[model samples]
Target: MSTKQENIKQLIEEYMKVNQMGPGDRLPSETALSQSFRVSRTTLRGAIRQLESEGKLLVKHGSGTFATCPLPSIPSSLDRLYSIGDMIRSAGLREDEQLESIQRISVCPPDIAEQMRFSENEPMIALERTRTANGEAVAHSINWMPEKLAGPILEGDSFSGSLFQSLEFKAGVRIVGAYSELTVPNYDDAHMTRLLKDPQATVLLLKQLHYDEMNRQVLYSLDYVRSDIFRFWVRRTR
Candidate 1:
């Protein structure tokens, strides 16, 4: 890192510290920051983008950048990739899953079908599970599978069990890529009320379509993550 960059980074840190800016808080504009520090706008932009990629900030479309979830490491990108188990375990957290509902059902909603590439009326295996880290409820996940493949999975799976393992070992399938979307919402639904403490809790929802290495969609999952306990990052090449 260059000395100029180091100085600019320190400036950002000082600003955040002085403002007591926690996650999701908006930061000052680059123009304001540059003027305050008597630096060029390009330098300020680089610094802000650095903080963004570092997970210290998030650049929202149309709006200025805001403080975001804490950054653990550049390599552990919870959003870009990683299993739920791996994502939590990589953060030095002890994680477990509580199976709430795991049942076979026929017919998925059309919107859901569009996301998972399934017909509007396909039979699917629906599994709703809660993920706990350090004995606290951190996330709730719902997974859907095709009936032909998922009809045989029993409920004897433990908290330490991997869903991928269950799928591959029991049903003979592998997961490769996932098409996912992340958002923060005011969680006040029945599931959130039962599993979380606050009705106003901010949740990081990850809606994913899990595809195998052969490029066949296998699983549709909805991961509702606690914004407080978990954070995810994304990296882009300049």
Candidate 2:
């Protein structure tokens, strides 16, 4: 995001705070906002679109933009990549800080090595945790990343909360996007069944290849989500 865009976003947020705008409240017209901010219509629209993508605003056809209702469950913001911890906190849910496992891989698995674009013998770090919401296990996630990107944090106790945040704060790397894949896992799978502990449970499997600002692959993750606890949907815009 550019500085001007950040200013416009902050300005709009302040406007809402000052006016005490709630859900369904209409925002100022684009023309009025453009003129008031002294920015081009294109720039103003870009900032508004960013807010919309974040689920902060809604745009109606033939009607003006309005404040959207609070998110019920985490919606897929395909345009922007975010950390699992951030999503949990955004929905007012509790996060379990207990890590199931974290270890270093001296010999990278072939498939994972290919995904991270690492040499066959190159090392990596794996982190696994079971996330909870309201004291119930909601998901189990396993993440792998290049040692160069996560070595220190993975080896130390500082690896808590959002790994994305940890990477940025510890290593100065910013994630910008991800290649995501969603699927329904088979109930008979031993590993998944053991993690979920219910044969009849419905599960949503998410696999993502995370990329940094320069489009370099930084991390890969697999998450097994309990569908009964958390529902996910994609937002499509023409």
Model 1 clash pairs are: none
The residue-by-residue lDDT of candidate 1 on 93-137, one tens digit each, is 777888887666677877778877789788877788888776767
Instruction: In angstroms, give how far residue 213 of model 1 lies from its true place.
Output: 1.3
Per-residue lDDT for 41-142 in model 2, tens only? Answer: 888887887677555778786899898654346544645566666667777877665587777888999999888798879788888887776565667888
Model 1 misplacement above 4 A: 1-80, 155-160, 198-200
TM-score of 2: 0.64
Residue pairs in clash, model 2: none
Collision count for each candidate, in order: 0, 0
Tell how far residue 26 is off in model 2, in angstroms.
46
Model 2 score (lDDT): 0.76
lDDT of residue 191 for candidate 1: 57
For model 2, state the Cα shift of residue 101 in Å. Answer: 1.1
| lDDT, residue 85, model 1 | 76
Cα lDDT over the full model 1: 0.73
